[model samples]
Each structure stands twice: as C-alpha cells, then as structure tokens.
Target: MTAPAALAGFDEVEAYHDAWWDEIVAQAQAPAEVDIYDKDWRFLSTVDDAISGDFTDLYNDAGEGKLAQLAANPVAQWISENVTEAEDLHVRVTQSHTEWAGKAQTIEESMDSDGFESMNISFLHDLQHAKKIYCYPNPFFLLQVQWPKIYPYFGPSVTGVKTLLHLNLLRRYQPFWRLPADIFSKTAWAQDFEAANWPHIVNPRGTGLFNDTSMHCIIATRMGNFYDVVKAILEDAGLQLTATRWLPGDEQPFPEYATITMPTLIWDVVDKGGVRGKTGTLLDGFMPFVRSILGDNIQETKTPVPYEEPQEYSEDKWGTVKEVPAVVWYAAQRYTTATGTGQSGIVKWRKTQHKAIASAILTGGKSPGWVNTGVKLIANAILGYIGMIFLNPGLALGIFDEQIEDVILAFARADLTNLRDEMGRDAYGEYWESSGQNGFSPSTLAAFRTGQMAVQPYTSFQVEVVNGQPYWYGMHAVMGDRVSMELGMSGVLYTDQIRTARLTFGPNDPVGWTLAVGKDDDDTSPTARLARVLQAVSTIAQQIAVQS
Candidate 1:
C-alpha cells in the first residue's frame, strides 16, 4: 500500500535507499583483509577478512550482513549540510555581535559605577568574549526507523564504529553468542531460566523485547528545512506536530516547535515471572548455585536416526576434524546424579542425539577438565531453560524540543557585543556597521561556546585559544542548548596540539551517559542527554498510560 499524499517524498526516499543499497553492494570491494586502525584503543583494532577474500563468505558471515545493512547511509548529506551551515552561521554570528557591541558601549558609558563593575565586566565579557552557537537534536535513525531494523547486530558498538565493535564483541564474547538467536538479538540474557522452566522452548517467538535507546544529538543530525526537520525528528520518536501558529505580528511561526505527548501507552505483564518466585529465597539460591557449578543439565532423550549411521565431518578449534553421527535430536532431561558412592560421569546422553558442533569439542580433546560432561549438561539445560521478558525501549520518545522555547529565551537575554570591541572582534579590525562575514569561516571552534547549544561538555572540545584571556569569567558558562558550564578561572588550557571535540564533556554535564555512546556514533550530544533524562522521568507515567 502507498503512504498518504502527505508522505510523498518519503516513499521516493525509501526507493532511493533500496536502489542505493544494491548499487553500493555492487561497488563494494572486498579485500583479503582490512586492518582497522583505532587511535584510542588498540584492542579495538582487528583485521576483517570476513569481507576480504570471498564473496560467498561475505554473504554467509554474520558481520558483513550487519555492515551491508548499514552501508550507504546519508552521512554525506549531513557533511554537506554542516559545511554550508558553518558558513551561514559564521555570517550570522559576526553580524549580530557587531550590532550588539555598538549599543553596549553607549549604555555602559552613560552609567559608570563600582557596583556596575561586575555588570560592566559581565556585559563587556559577553560582547567581546562569549560566543553563541546553534543547537538542535541529532539522533541516529532520525527517521521513524528502529535500530533493530537497521543495526541488526543487536548491540551498537560502544566506539560507534559498526564493523570494529561488531567484530570485537563477537570475538570477545563467543560464549555469549551461543545464546538463542532471539535473546542474543536483544542483547539480553536470562540468568535464571530454570524458574520459568525456560519458557522460550515452548514458545520461542514470545521472548523478543524492544528497547528504546534512541539518543538525539548534533553530530548525528542531518540538514533540512526547519519545518520538515522538526517533523522528521518527532516522527523518529513516534510523535506528531499537532499545532502551528504565526507570531502575534510576524509572518514567521512563533516558536517553530511541536508539542509531543503520549496520551496512552500500555504494557501489562501479569506473568511477571511469578515463575522465579521459588528462586527468590536464600535457600533456593544455594541450590541454584550448586546446580550452576555442576549444571542441572538436560540431555537429549530422542534422535531421529541411530547412532551407527554414517557421520558428518566437522573441524575443531585445534585444527583437527572429526566425524560425528548425523541425526535430528529432541527432548532433554535433567543431568544424572550419583546413585551411590559417587556419580559415574557428569552427564549421560544418547550419543545419537548429541549435537555435532558440541560433540566435536569433547572428542577433539579441546574440552577442558572443568568442562566435564555434568558441567556441560547443566550449562546446556540452564541456557535452554533461560528465558527473558522484554519491554521495547521504544525509540527516543523524549520531548527533545520540550525545552526549545526556554533555551531560545535564554539566548535572547544575551546582549550583543559592544561597539569598540566589536571592531577588534572583526577580522582585520574593520567593523562593518552592517556586519560582514569577512574571515569568519565557520569552524569546529564554535562547539565550545558555553550554554545550551554548547557542545564542549555535551560532546567534545573543538576550540583552541592561544595566549588569550578566558571569556567565561564575565559571562555565564551556559553555552548554547542549555549546557551547564564547568570552567574554572584557569579557563581553557592553551596547547598547540590539535584536538577534536572527542573528549571534552565540559564540567558538570552527564558525561557518563554518553561515554559508552561515542561522538563518532552521533549519540553523544546535549540533546541526547537531556532527552534521556526527560524520558526516564516519565517512565512510570508512560507505564501507567500503557496499562490504562
């Protein structure tokens, strides 16, 4: 079915995306191996040959599927938007700063007093030193798409590099990968499934859960018209723009923001694992722990074919290949325990029904002593009995634009730069009454401007001032988007070293929130942090709404 006429461009964009995917795959070159260079962490570096030599392997290997799913993203579009935006922004800032500076001098000269000393200092500082920057939410998956639909790898990389983290996570946690596909895809594990009798086996499809980990930030934002841009962001959060009104006297819209609210959203889990109620006790914990160490393993009690049937050959980690019986298996029972003086072996399973991949380890001598039959059996039982309940974290349902009006009002209060200093502030000391862009090339330095839109504490540090006095002293540290400031009298440290806004999360900002979410991943921005905080605030409210 076609979307409504209102969504005209959306379909075309979707078609473009499909075609783009096909084209990129054809254009994609798979080398023997690609050495990944990570400046921050060497352990993150690896040689990805999964896409290196063979096309067939590329399709079969899991990593390529994940990368291919994410390739041809509109990163170029964002880069281009930012390039033009920087120039335009530089022009706007210089013009505003010049006009404000002129009016400031006249007001200050008329009233000079000691009490006004701090006010003068503050006023002068704002004009000559403090900066104003533009900010807006830039969440990944800005469209109404969910992560699982795009980032199928289940867990987004902490480093924001898909290929790097996917490979690293897989290599680092091979054991975790063995989890049932449904649980692994959700990046969750059932630590205690025995209580529920591992319900997933009876109904595998019911275990999947959704989590809304959407983080809105600047680095991840794409450039677009203001109206359409707001709508797109809202859609990503499953919201709608229900109102639009012009200013009292102006033709332009008043605030240019949308009011987003979820009147109702319900999720009732009546079966809240009253299943694990037995395991809740201190005594129960001991039994589970003992069972865990030795494994309350369940072994296959049935096989479709006899153990004597011709076997299949499988390779082991130690390079040896062995033949194991080929058969379909079903049904497992708890591990066999000692009947008398002692137990004969850890577990007793029908050889015909044993899984070949696992049997290979036992026969290939790769199984460690700790991995005795009983331990293996119990581990398998726990994994199969393990089941998890999930609640879709739903996309970024945060009212990110919630504080837009407040933020804008805060910026409006900032007076302009003064007349004399405005000239010095201008390039070549030529102050244009009607400001000129001149050499004000928009650069990354604007990222550090303190306040709401400020990126310093929210994302990274992008500015470098050399042998110059600090500006935050007289000015409020609030940069742009509502960022709380963390500058001391020492201000910014002047060093010759070129730094990206990679590591500077300002002073009192929620640095930990985005630490796992990296700047390159476009998930580490002030908007993302604020949105997360706001969304968390209403979890119970949302839950109640859901129940209603």
Candidate 2:
C-alpha cells in the first residue's frame, strides 16, 4: 500500500513557497512614504531616519565581505564545495559566552598588573593584551588630567570620554580578538588608537553626548586601524589583505560606504517637512495651519508703530484704523508631551474637544443609517455649542425659533433609530447584520457603532450643518435612555473646505476657539481679526444649541 501523504511534505510545496517568497520580497522593497504618517497626525521622518541609519550601518560594516564573496562564490556553489568547512567555522565563532568570558578573564589578568605611570599607558597596555576589552569609563577623565589644555580643544566635553572608553573597550575585548598577532603590533595599535580618538580632540560642540560627526570620526579611525591590522595578519597567514581591500576605484565598496553616510529624512512639520540637504527647504508642505479664532477692536494699517510720542497736530498720525469686536488667540501647539514639555494652553483645549467629539459620535446601537445620523448630530451639537458662545443671542433665537425651547424640539425630531442605522452603515460595512448574535443588544450595537462603548451610562448626540447654508449644531447627553442633561446653542457655523472654525469646551468651563480663514483676501482686511472672533462665537452657539 502507498504510504499516506506526510504532513512534512506539504511544507516543501514549491508553488506555495514561491508565492510567499514573492510577497515577502515585495513587502521588503515597498516605498517607505506610505507609513510616514501615523494615526495621531505625527510625522515619522525622524524615526525612520534613525532606524535606517542603524540598520544600514550594521549590515554594511559587519557583512559586506561575506556579501561580496556570495557574488563570486554563490550560495549554491559554496554549499556544494565547502558546506562542512563553512559549518565548522560558524561553530567556532559561536562559542559560548561562559567559555569566551573565561578566555577574556585570562587575557585581562595577563595585562592587569603592568604598573604603567600614566592612565594612557596603562590603558594602552590593557587594550593590547585583551583578546577583547572595552573601556567603560569616559576618556575625558584621563584627557582632563593628562592634557588639560587639550580638553578645551575638543568639542563639548559631555560624553566624549564615555564614548571613547566604550569604543576602546570594544576594540580590546571584541574586534581586536579577531586580529592576528602581526596586526596587533605596537605601531599599528597606536595608530589605530590615535585615529579612534582624533575627532574628540577636534570638534566638541555637540548637542548630545553622542554627536554624529564624533561618532563618524570614531568609526572611521577604528575601522581604518582595524583594516591595517587585518592586512598585516593576513599577510603573515600567507593571505593578501590587498585581495580583501576595496580599492578606491571599486564601485561596490563606495556604494556600501555611501549608504552609511546617507542623511536621514529628518522632518519637522512645523518648520521644514523633510530631510534637508545643505540648502533649500528640507520639509515639504510644512506650514502651520494658522487661524484667527476671535479678536475685537483690532485694526489693520500699513503704518508702523510710532517710535516716539506724536506732537499735538502732527499730520504724520493719519493712518487707517479698523475697529474689532474682541480678541481670541487660537494656536496649534505641536510640542510632544513625551519630551516632558507640558501641554500648552492651545493643546490642552484641542485634547478636550477631540475627546468630547469622539465620545459623542460613538455612543449608540449598531445601525449604519442611525450611526451616520448620530455622527452628523454630534458634529452639529459640537458646532452649535461653539456658535452660541460667540454668536449674537438674538440671531441664535431666530434660527432655532425659541433658542432654549427649540433645542429640545430639534433633538425630539431627530430619528434616533434611523440615525443609528445610518451611522453603522457609514462607519461599519453592510455585512454587519444586527442579529442579536454575539450578545449585541440594540443599545450596545448603537454605542459600539458610535464609539460609546463605555459601560458607565452616558448620552450620545451631535449637531452639524447639512448643506452649504449656515445652520444650528448642538447635542444633549442622556442616561437610562432619557435626556438627563443638555447644553444648548453653544456655538455656530457651517463647514467650508477653504475656511474652518474649531472651538474647544473643557470640564473646568474653559472655552477656546480657532478660526482658520485660509488664504482669502478678507483674511488681511482691517476687521479680519474681529470677524474671526464673531465667527467663532457664532459657531460655539450652534454647538450648544444641538448639544443641549
């Protein structure tokens, strides 16, 4: 009888494997820009730059030689010719930490008691003796004492000593172990040490402990010395270092090295958006979104402020003066709280409104139509509240027919069930049939669709303008399926792609408004600031009307 098909055989299915491999390669090579924008609207250019630099440097510096060999002696060729030998070499290099630690200890003891007069001399001796050693202490400690004048000659003396110590220790304990005795000769070692420490001796004004230039200098110096050491050792072993050396004319090495020094895409959305190369704007489309939320008694004039008091009848005092109603500052503070920069007044305001709006939109049973209606209602409510605060009360009452009385009438007129259905359809797919399966109650579904999943009883509602025409927007909170509390005619306004207004309502009763007029001609008008403030108030009133 034929043996039943083994499960292990399925793993080697050629077609299946090939398809997966293709997908993997495509994913690896995908353009990076797609992931540059995160959910919170934060830019990821700086993070990408940091990760890319680290990844490329590690691969090129450590694996370039092996990669080159793989070209001439392909993987298939190597496997067929010297698989066993390669396996043995890999095994030898993979020695256990315990075994290596013992060997390192022996070497350390051998060089420990060398009683050198100066710290530099003792350090050099220990470094030479160790198969692998890393100096943990800062090099500045020695530099300050041995060469006091030289301390100021180097860049900012923050962590240079620590870095030098780390690199020197790595040379002694790790990479140096790979070097043969001929490469470890006194002259080569000294040259390597000097090169490794030279940059610290030069530029010192670093913003952080590890400056980029300083790091580059350290790496180049150490690598150059290491190359020399390896070259000498290879010659002694009847192998030519020149054979491994990537000559100046070599394209392969140059590309790999260039990759190491490539500037990362560092972007600041508030300033310049993307990686800059010496001149010109680095970031693209990075201007801050500016809006005049509220202002009063403001006037625009071409005339500059007087430097001195004007005489009683000075004719020079004639200039345009436009009256503004009130003044309100609306700003976007992008400073990160993670960096310990506490939230600015503007940022705090944004957070409050964002949370409130999110809560209001996502609080009801699951129904697409109902959900959309709810979202619109919630937006309307938010906008209405904002409008009421800034709009004239007489105008607000006319629009709603009774101001306070009409606010409740509008909420009662809203088809909560239909609104829930619309919201679900807009937010979730049509496939979501409210089957009462999955323990989903109508109210639970509504809440989930609206994003009001919290068990603590709360109300969900919103207000928004439907057409290009201006309208009242507001919301009311309810508990136990009944309106327990309401906020009315708080703010006003309609949504325009070119012009937008935002108002933030806080628990502490703090209120703020943002009016973005875009690049319109009216924005520069003498009464622009006051107009903005009035617009914000109008929007706030509309929000309160719906919310209440």
Candidate 3:
C-alpha cells in the first residue's frame, strides 16, 4: 500500500512548460562524457565528481577503515591503475556481503520479523554493506500510482518534455545490466552458485541486469547436506553463515524455507546478446561501448516550478488533482465528470506534489494526451491480458516496501500441493498434466520466499524440453502480477527484471519529473532518480499486470 500522487491539468501543463524550457536550454542530461569504455568489460561505474569528492574526504569525514585497507592492497592498486584511473573514478575494493551471513542470529530474527530484502534479493547484503555499495528503493515497485486515461489530450510540449526525460531514463537504464558480475564475479557467491545441485537459470555470459537469476535454494536447514551446500560456497566466497534456535524478535518457532537470489553473469550478456554497455542492444551480435555510447553529463538543472499547496476541491477554482489507487481509479469519475462545456484539455502534474487530475473527461472523449498515451496503454493492457490468459501460472514476486524495499519479501499466494503423480510423469510433468495447465495453477503457493525479496530469490524452476533437450526455463515473478512463466517458445521470458517489466506496464508506471515521483528515501542523485523512475516502472508493473 502506497500513498498516492496527484497530477492536474494546470500543474501538468506548467511542468510541461518547465521541461520544454529546460530542453530548449539542453539542461536535462549527463554532465560530461565519461571514459568508461576501457573499464566496460567489468560491471563497474566510474565515480562522478560528486562521488570523487566524497572519496577524497572519506577518511577524514567518514573514517571508513576499509578504504585505508584497500588503498594499501596490491589488487586494489591494480584496479585503481587500470579501471578506476579517472579522478572521478576513485573507489576502494571491499569485502562482499558474506559477513552478515557468517553470523547466524540475524537470519533467525529477520525471519521472525515480517522481513524481505528490498533491492534484488541476492544483492541485499551487498547493498547494505554501505562501504562500496549503497541501496536505492526498488524504483519500479511503487504500489499506488497509475497513468491517466486522458493522456491523449496533453499538448506537444507536455509530451515532448516527458518523452525527453523518458528516453534519457531508458538510455541510462539499458546499460546497467552489467554491474552484478563486475561486483561479484571474483567471489564465491557466483562460483558456488554455479556448482550447486539445484537447477538454476542464468545468462550463460554471467549475471544480466535484465535476466532472471533465481535458483532453488534452501534458505536454512539443520541438515548439513543443504546447509553445507550454501555455507561452504558462501564461506569460500568469504561470506559467513548464520544459524539460530529462535526467530529474530519474538520467541517463535522458526523453521527454514526455500530461498534463492539472482547472480551475476555479465560476460554472458555480451558474449550472447552483445549489450556491452551500449544504450541500444543488438541480440544478433556485439555492440561495443565507445565514447559515443555515453552521453554528456547534465551540468545545469532546471529549477522546478512549484504548485500551491492543495486545498479541498472547490468548483469555482480548480482543485488539486484527485489521487486514487490505479486498480479502482475508474470509480473516481465522480470527481470530474466531463461537462462538455469545453474540450478536455491537457492536465497539470502538480509541481513537487503528486496528485491525480479531476476525472473531467467524458468516456470516449478525445484528447491528444489520450491519443498519445491511450494507444500505448491499451496495447500494454492487451498484452497483460494475454499473459494472464495463457497461465494463471500460480507464482509471482512481491516485496513489502516500507518506503524502501529491503523491508520485506512476501508472496501473493502460498498453498503447497505435492503433485500426486496419478498418470506417472516426472514431478513437474505430472503436476501440469493433472492440472491441465503448462505451469503451476493458481493457489496460495503462487509466490513465496523465505527472506527479503531482493536478496532471496524465490525457489522455483521450470523444466522445458526444448527440441528434445531438457532445459531449465527461467522463473521470474514480480509483485502484484500473475506469475508470467512465459517460456515464449524462445529464450525471451517474462519481465520480472524490474527495468524491463515496468516500462512494459504502460501508464501504471509513474512517469514525471524526478523529484516528484515517490520519494526514494529522499535521495535525489541522478542514480537514485534513475532508480526511482526505472524501478517504479517495474514495481508498478505488477499492478498493471494484475489489474489489466
């Protein structure tokens, strides 16, 4: 459940003016061209001047001993010389998030509390490590917002400004698929994961930002066979394992459940799809990163226009846009039934404040905003409907986001049924055969994972006989949507990848100015803004998915 955002015609129109002015001045882009290609093979980002400043003042201001240790390490020095050579590229090598798992009590307690990792399940500890890593809200997952039906009415300036920001977001977003492997390729998390007994889906090249990396995992066990499998690998990767007798807070009898996480495989992405840090991807061959691939930094920022504080609706004066849940938005037509006095014109997305426009448009009314966004939204809705029709495939991913995602991992449903093999097929085959569906049927057990959603990948697998060759069909589920086990007769699967899925959700994904989107724990960095919009797109994807 999320607090709503409101957007009205006047405010939306005003912001349109600002974005238009900003674009005319070319103030909405990267600040400078970065020399990142030389280090593109690795999934690392060049530190910007801001991060460099933080690095320079780190020891005196932050007293992080890890930097002191790394500044002395030979490997760290080598990384500095070859990869992080830019003044802005200043960084320090630090240990992975294995340390938390080494100690067992936290796991025990976190299980007791209603908790799940907020970011990608597997990357939870890394993100929290706070030395080299930082956490951003799952930008795609905001629960309460949706795109409006009147979008076809917005003027060109409004659409143009939005398109500009949206395109920039997409460009910045597409290349980040390479970071996980760069962060973890040298560690045991990736190594042991590859050798594990469970069937897993991984990009053959490495971890993909857009690929599903979930695999079957036993989150915790008294049995060494299961425990050792994870423990040894994690320990080998220098991660510590935790054990417990009681749950985290209350003295509840806590047992273990299946836990899995996505892993890195960047080399596979390039070797296979050739998305080597390029804005656009070419599946047929490699597209190397060059200076041309990276855009110049945005040095100047447009000062945002502010809206007057929203007062209660008054007919004489226009009111703040009404906000409502996307699922129940149509019910809000009472707020602004189209009077037909004048044409339904472009609405204002409130400045800084998020509000819904009054429902003024009569049904079937025409507007450029609707014409523009309506077609796209309808197309997306149709696709979502088709997805639901194919398989009520009873599993999906969700996180209980307390402003940020690492708070909790939850399933939409969880009912366990041991497939009684009446017709005598393998477990999955028998189950699907009995159910008369190609995948798990809708049930309580639709989506369930033990720990945080971001760090703990759900434990499920798809066995596909592709051309008589048995393969593990990748399993990816996101919050609020039906389980899309779309083995699409090709390697292209569902959009559990937040970046891919949210954009696919059309209007449900909140698209507006960076600061106006759901607050990313108050972080306004370009990366954080990217996380908000990009993650919001995918986060809301489930909302669109379930509703459409």
Candidate 4:
C-alpha cells in the first residue's frame, strides 16, 4: 500500500507549490503603509527608529509570509506551463535572441559617438530584445516558467505587453535575468542559449540562477570573469556607473515583491488640506529658502556668565528665614567715599573701617559716567517707549525675523522642530480637516509627518566659484536614487553687492550651459537658481564662522 517513489517527489513539489501560491496571494492582499517626509522643510531624527521598529514589524507580520507563499507557488507552475510545448518555447526563444542581437548592433552603433568599440556582448541586451520580440505569444508561458521560479509566486501576473515591458526593462540591466540563472545553473552562460529560448530549462529545479534579487548578482553571475564589461561599456558610452553587490541569499527567489508603504506624513504634509501654501511646504522648495539664509554669513554666539553663589540668609528666633537684598553697583573710576563726624570736641568714637568691595560692571572705566551705565539703561527705556508708540509693530517685525531665521536654521540643522509646525498646521489643519473631513487628529498628522520625513532624500550643498566669483552648488535635492538639482548664474548681476555673476549646474561641466549672473538671461533655470542660493548660503556661513 506504500506510494511509489516517483509519486513522493511529485507530492512534495505539489505541496511546496501550493504553499508558495498561498504566500503570494497573502502578500498581494496585505495592507501596507507608506511613510512621508518633508525633507526640505523639516529635520527628522526619529525616522530611522520608526522604520526599524514600526515599519519592520508591520512588514514582517503583514507582508513577508504572504509574499513567500506567492513566490513559491508560481515557480512550481513553470514546469507544467511551458515544458508541455517545448517546441513553441524554443521558437520564441530563437526569435528573442535574434532581436536582441539586432539591438546589440544599435547599442554598438550608439557607442561610436563616444569612441566605444564593441567587445564582449551583453546578456541584458539579449534578454531584453528577446522579450520584446516574442512578447505577445510568450508572456503567459514565460511567466508560468519564469515568474514563479525567479520571483517566487509574487511575480506580477502580467501577460502580453505588460509582461514584455517588464522583461525587456529587467533584461536591459542584466540584474533581472541573472537572478534566475544564478539560482538554477552552475554556469549561467552555459545555459544562455537554452535559457534564451526556454528560461525554465536553465533552472528546472528552481534553485540556482532563478533566485537572484539584486541587479548586481545578475551582472556578477553572467559576466563574473570579465570585471571590465560594465566598466568598458559605461566608460565607452560616457555614462556614469554606480554599482554594488546584493546581500547573500538575496539573489534567491522570493515569493513576492517587497511592498513599500507610503508614510502617512506624505499625505499630511502634501495634501491640499495639509499645510499647503505655507512657507517651506514643498519639501523640495524649502531647501533653497534655507540655503538663502543659513548659507550666508549667519552666525550664532553664546556668552556665558560665571555662576556666583547665592548669599545665605539668617533666621529669626521663630526660625523664619529672610534673604538680605543685594544691590549691583557700577562706577566709572575708583573713588572712595569718606564719612567724617564734625562734633565740637567729642571724638565721636571714630572707627575707621575700610572693606574692599568690587563693583559689578560691564565696561572698564572710560568716557563719561552717563555713557557707561546710564546710556544702556536709557537706550533700553527709549526703545521700550518707541516700541509702545509703534503699537508693537517693530516688536512684531523683530519676532517675525527671529521666527524666519529659526525656520531656516531648523532646516539646516535638520532639527525635529521643523515637523512640529508642519504636523500641526499642514497635516492636521489642511489634510485631515479639509481632505479627511476632520477624521484625522493632530496627533495622527504628527505621527504621519514624522514617518514621511524619515524616508525622504537627504541633501548636502557643495560650493564652487565660477568666472572668478562665488555661486551656490548642491546635489541630491528632491528625490533619492540618482535625482539631483543645481543652481548657477545666468548673467552678471552688476549690482552693488556683486560685480558680476553667472549660473551653471553642479555635478556637470559648465561649458555650454552657463548663464550670466545679473542680466535678464532667460537661461537662469531652476538648477541655476538652486546653485546660486547654495553658494550664497555657503559663503555666508563661512564668513560668519570666520568672523566669530
């Protein structure tokens, strides 16, 4: 009554596949949250903590299990889906390879402008072109074989154009195809022709080349012997290249795609009901404003007064203690006051008591007494009177100045206080009240903002002088993952402050795109403006620091 040995393997595979499907479906249905941050407007310190604590927990509980199931199921389905008609799969594979070879020719032709000579071939081009060529007829079969095996069951259930687009995009980078090959085969290249036609054949066991998650893994596995392939291609084409390796076991096939939830803070700050129209509302916009002030000659100074011991008090017979009053005295010069008793002949018990006492003073003895102590007190009183006469308008102006400066510095220091106003005013007032119909509370908005800022891109300013004058320079302004902004002069300002100015972009040469500093040069693009502010702020900060 025992089951056949062959049936045992099939049973195990079926069970694994079923589990994988369950995992993928669970992942797709799981609830996700995204964190938003006002990188330009607020400084966030607690973001990393929140990500590790709250986000990580949520991901583990709600996402990981389901994704695992989905990724696992689809892999098992691949063998049954495409292996049934290996002939069709081979024809599709051949067409794909031919198309890829044609595209490789185009890539080589493009490289000619940059002095690039074709050398070793790129598997990415081959895969991408192949997918494009056989997109319509191949996706369903390919997905059955590739998706589950490569991404686990969580790979998107795409067919036709969508499938082609995904495959083509994935293959252009080499990171995508190499994942399956690395997990399934010992020699990825040995299986290239077979995989080019039937990717499932490359990794029938669903273990080796099929599981790689990182793009780098694909590159390494495909062209490990030729370290110079990527370098040569990118260099020859004059393209910047930044590459890194994937974590160990990361290349293994997973059941689902990692779902990144948007942080509540993004909605709170960015929603119409949120703090819209407020200064520094747009995280991207606020950066330049901050640089405008902090990048300049802004300095902070602190003067410390030595602590003096408090005079002790004496108690009466009732044990009620009373402190004696002390008076602060000031004098311009050392002058002794003498008390004499003029009585006809009675030497009024003349007791000469001379005690040394130093007066508390701000300045050395100089000028008139009125100018030393009296002037400061008089100035203060006059200023107070003037303030009253102006009905606190001047005071309001002063307060406004301080607050504005605070906003700028808060951004520069990336202080948490920046989020306070954003959460209270933007998220709570605008987003929740207007958009969410008051369903969201201020506390919730605050939490959301905190989460959002955690993931936003961090920017740093770099300054360089062009045309023998100073200008702002910055990088990685708006978004992460290779997005950046720069500012430069369009023309000479010809103003009292600056003799001349020009605008340009940073992380790029300023040869053809330079803008004159001050004149009405329409070439003063956003990048140039950003550069200007960055340079100005940097200059100001350096000057202030030096002066202090």
In the order shown, what is each candidate's alpha-carbon RMSD?
34.4, 34.9, 30.6, 35.0
Which lDDT tens digits does candidate 1 get at residues 129-248? 101111112222223433322121212111122222222223222322333444323223343121122101111111222221221111121121222212222222222111111112
Tens digits of per-residue lDDT, candidate 2, 1-548, equal 75457745665587689998677544433322211112222222211111110000010012110111112223323323443421211100100110000001110111135542111000011112221222322322332243221111122112232233334543433343333232223443344333222211111122232222121011111111222222111211111111111112323322211221221111000101112223222111111101100111111112234333123212323212111111111122322335323322222111012111121222212223334355556655766777878883222223442223322212101122332443453432112111111122222232232222211122222222121111111111100011101123232111111123222222232222222321132223466468545744654454234223
**Candidate 1 off by > 4 Å:** 1-167, 173-177, 182-463, 466-548
Error of 4 at 446 (Å): 21
Q: What is the lDDT of residue 180 in candidate 2?
A: 29
Worst 10 residues of 2 by lDDT: 94-103
For residue 104, model 1's alpha carbon misses the true position, in angstroms, by: 53
Off by over 4 Å in 4: 1-166, 169-185, 192-459, 463-548
Query: Backbone clash tally for model 2?
Result: 130
Regions more than 4 Å wrong, model 3:
1-28, 32-416, 420-424, 428-548
How accurate locally is residue 122 in candidate 4, as Cα lDDT from 0 to 100?
A: 14
Ranking by lDDT: 2, 4, 3, 1
Error of 4 at 463 (Å): 4.1
Kindly list the per-residue Cα lDDT of model 4 for residues 1-548, writing each as its tens digit: 98999999999999999999677544432322211112121211111111111100010001000011111223223322433322211100011001101111111112257564221111111122221222211222333353211111112111111222333333432333434423223354344323322221111221212221111111111111111212222211112211111122324222132211221100000011111223432332333223322421111122345533233311111111112111111111211223211211111111122211111101111122223244445545666678889886233333233222212111111122333333343322111111100112221222222222222222222211222111111110100111111222221111101112122111222211111211121233586468546744654454234222
Report the CA-based lDDT of candidate 3 relative to the real structure: 0.22
Worst 10 residues of 3 by lDDT: 52-61
TM-score per prediction, in order, is 0.13, 0.15, 0.16, 0.17
- Over 1-548, each residue of candidate 3 has an lDDT whose tens digit, in order, gives 53344546667789999988666334222132111112112324432221111010110011111111123334333444564323222122211110111000111101225443111011121111112111111212222332331111111111212222222222233322322333223343343233122212212222233332211122211111222113222211112222111112322221121222222111011111111232332221121111111232101112335433334322444333432111111111232445322211112111132221111111111123323344445555665677688865322222311222211121122112211122123322101111010111111111122101111112332211111011111111111111112222232222111111110011222211110111112233576468546644653343233323
Q: Estimate the lDDT of model 2.
A: 0.23
